[model samples]
Target: MNGRSRARALGVLPGPLPTGPLNAITDVAGVLVGHTTIDDGADLHTGVTAIVPATVRALPAAVHTGNGYGKLVGSTQVDELGVLESPIVLTGTLSVFRAADAVLTYLMGLHPGELSFNPLVGETNDGFLSDIRRRPITERHVLDALEGAHGGLPAEGCVGAGTGTTALGYKAGIGTSSRRLDAGGGPVTVGALVQANFGGTLTVRGVPMPVEELVPGAGRVEPPGNSCVIVVATDAPLDARQLGRLARRAIFAMGRVGASYSHGSGDYAIAFSTADPAPALPDAVLSPVFAAVMDAVEEALLNSLFMATTTTGVEGHTSHAVPYDRL
Candidate 1:
């Protein structure tokens, strides 16, 4: 939607399900997304991404950790209480804590008398391209992302938290996709956003990408451990337990995109529902939603790679973008 070519435009459809109007996480009613990219000419290529639901109050949510190698602040509480009380923020690994603090600062202003709160923040290592050790992210950057969130198509690739990220040896950043389901009792939309920075052979649909042929000598420059953070949103009435199941489906979708889920890869998925309080859907009707999650996630992961531009950062490390023409 932002003028950049996405997976669908390239005939790389991940599934048969129809997408929402915008084909983004924002397609879920009441969901909003925003980003604050910090791209200094060189050395610093990092920033923040914020996902906010309609209300500030706690919403039904769940988290799934495929590999617990990275930090995901406030995940325990969400797993225990089955709810999220703050906007979800994503950023570079080292900046996670600072981002959480910023979320707390912003939420405190919204609820004056609230004595306690849990801020959800996730991260992926971007040290390969960004000067992550410097921790360039500030409270202002995080605040800007939260305050600027809107309901519509969000910018993808080389932006926000994805600025310096890479996936499967290709430059990748933020990517998003959505699906509309009509079989789960009624029409509902499911959407996913990903900060892809992991390792493995790139795969599209089911075919492995010819990375070596397309980008001669392209190889991993980062250290062993990398990470990916996925955020899934739906407008269906699902309880925390059900959302947990949905989150797992999102994690599984990574395999469809050739994610190795390596020893050091901290892969995580956080799923939440925007539907108002109501009776949860029966287990028999959840299959369609699960399928939608996998499809949306696969497409989102591909979008992260395809939409990204080649970037050079940190010392002399360069990550090449996937050659769309070759694919």
Candidate 2:
């Protein structure tokens, strides 16, 4: 049976796959998610910052996977150091600059009586539902999301970066899932969290679940494209190339759900592990370690698809929930 068909027939949501303790991105331990949504004005279904912290500590090591096709600030430095020392930020497309600035300001306020800051911010296009031109993300909003960040089942649907998002011929938003892997000896956790703003016909395990069949009024603009921003976290030991390989496999899972990766889509993935850090001093060679990245990435993509909920955005545009009953 197709994925959706199977889900509908059994009356199940796909995210119930065998998981770790929390069945969420937080299962990885030390990871956290936070949101800030704005719907004050008509047709303005957008707002400010959502921070995804790499670790519970204020600063931790990080790395970026897919840096092209979208505006991601501070990725270059992350690549060089292989450590993310800032909170990950997300906002509407045009609000990236403002969001980045706000993150910087928020960082300065993080410590007591200290003021020095540099933050990482990523974005997706929400122009259709949000007033992208207004750049509504503010410093206070960024701080709130960061301050509120916690480790637990992250609030999904019309919240955070996914507040104005859609996916797979349905009203999609922020979704998360995790998997536990037996790498050689002990168990390692791998998790995925996504801001699903992409557009496409729904095809679950090969079933034809297009926009026309489900969300009728939710047609895309000319060129017919959508984008997805995925953040993968793991405790596995992997280098940059391995992380990139893991990110690439995420696209394959997207295809399994029937994503076309249309021209206008910003299909991107960023993956990092808090495992052993590479050597810093000269002449210190690091041994290659590759174990659970691929498996984790595959499961993570499915989680993003399965955990998402339906949504409504700008000008009365609404996307339906995945027809669990139809599956």
Candidate 3:
């Protein structure tokens, strides 16, 4: 409910190129991000609902990536035909199925007589700071985050699902960044936001630093191994194949911050473009254009890592803030 500036954090990639107005995923015209943080009871360090709304009613588009290891419900249909018709919800790992169900239920309620609604829900584990086993997220929380979604700069750090996330050796949470691409017609925008639940040695601009170097490790939650979720959004007209490429480029952003994509890391990136509406047919003859998708994906990856601040989470887990002063 309150807003504050994040501490020093590094981008997954370099900067200096043109960025969107807010340098956030929401900058991708019509995209919105919202969150709800639950910090009350001694052990209730978790809450739910972080939503990125669809740009238009029954919008047509294609999904470019696939993850066999994790479940991105509604993505299979999206990849088969390269289109999406729903909002995106990010949450704690165990809440994926529940959130997906809630999203479908909500959509059905909205449409009244709709046959299907493939809700998109993504998850990252937050058991270290939160009681994931309790499944703290609820249908009401999901609706609250969705109803509150709006186009503007998104909040960062210990908020929303990110409340329990960690990154590059510190307690980290939601971070966002964006860039404008040189489209032939005009500049297309691509932006990225992340829920950082991964941990390891912290490095920025090739300068290596121990995660503990920034913050002491006494009487705190030990950083979990790598596990992070990145959401990339753009307004470039691109097909599924191109979007997949963009998703891969996001790893470069992770590399810039000294990530090795460890065994336990659930490093996943989902990239989408709102430039062209998704047609409802599987065989719709839509001309594909992807110049902007490439640039936008790369930029968005950087944004996810850059805009985050250091945080401390459950059991006194503390992470050093990106030391802008040190830089």
Which one wins on TM-score?
1
Candidate 2: C-alpha RMSD after superposition: 5.4
Overall local distance difference test of candidate 2: 0.60
Question: Per-residue lDDT for 1-327 in model 3, tens only?
Answer: 333343222333444456677767788787888787776534445445454646534443443322234455677766666556677788887878888887887788778877966787777776776666788788888888877888787776667877776666555667776777665455567777777766555665567766445444523233543466677777666656666666666654666566656666767666777766342212222121233333443343333334445444556555445444443
lDDT of 1 by residue, 57-176 (tens): 779999999999999999999999999889999999999999999999999999999899899999999998888899989999999999999988999999999999989878899999
Ranking by TM-score: 1, 3, 2
Higher-scoring candidate on TM-score, 1 or 3: 1
Off by over 4 Å in 2: 1-17, 48-67, 110-118, 215-225, 278-312
- At residue 262, candidate 1 shows an lDDT of 89
**Poorest 10 consecutive residues by lDDT, candidate 3:** 280-289
Better of 1 and 3 by lDDT: 1
Give residue 301's error in model 3 in angstroms: 7.0
Q: What's the residue-level lDDT of 220 in candidate 2?
A: 42
TM-score of each: 0.97, 0.79, 0.81
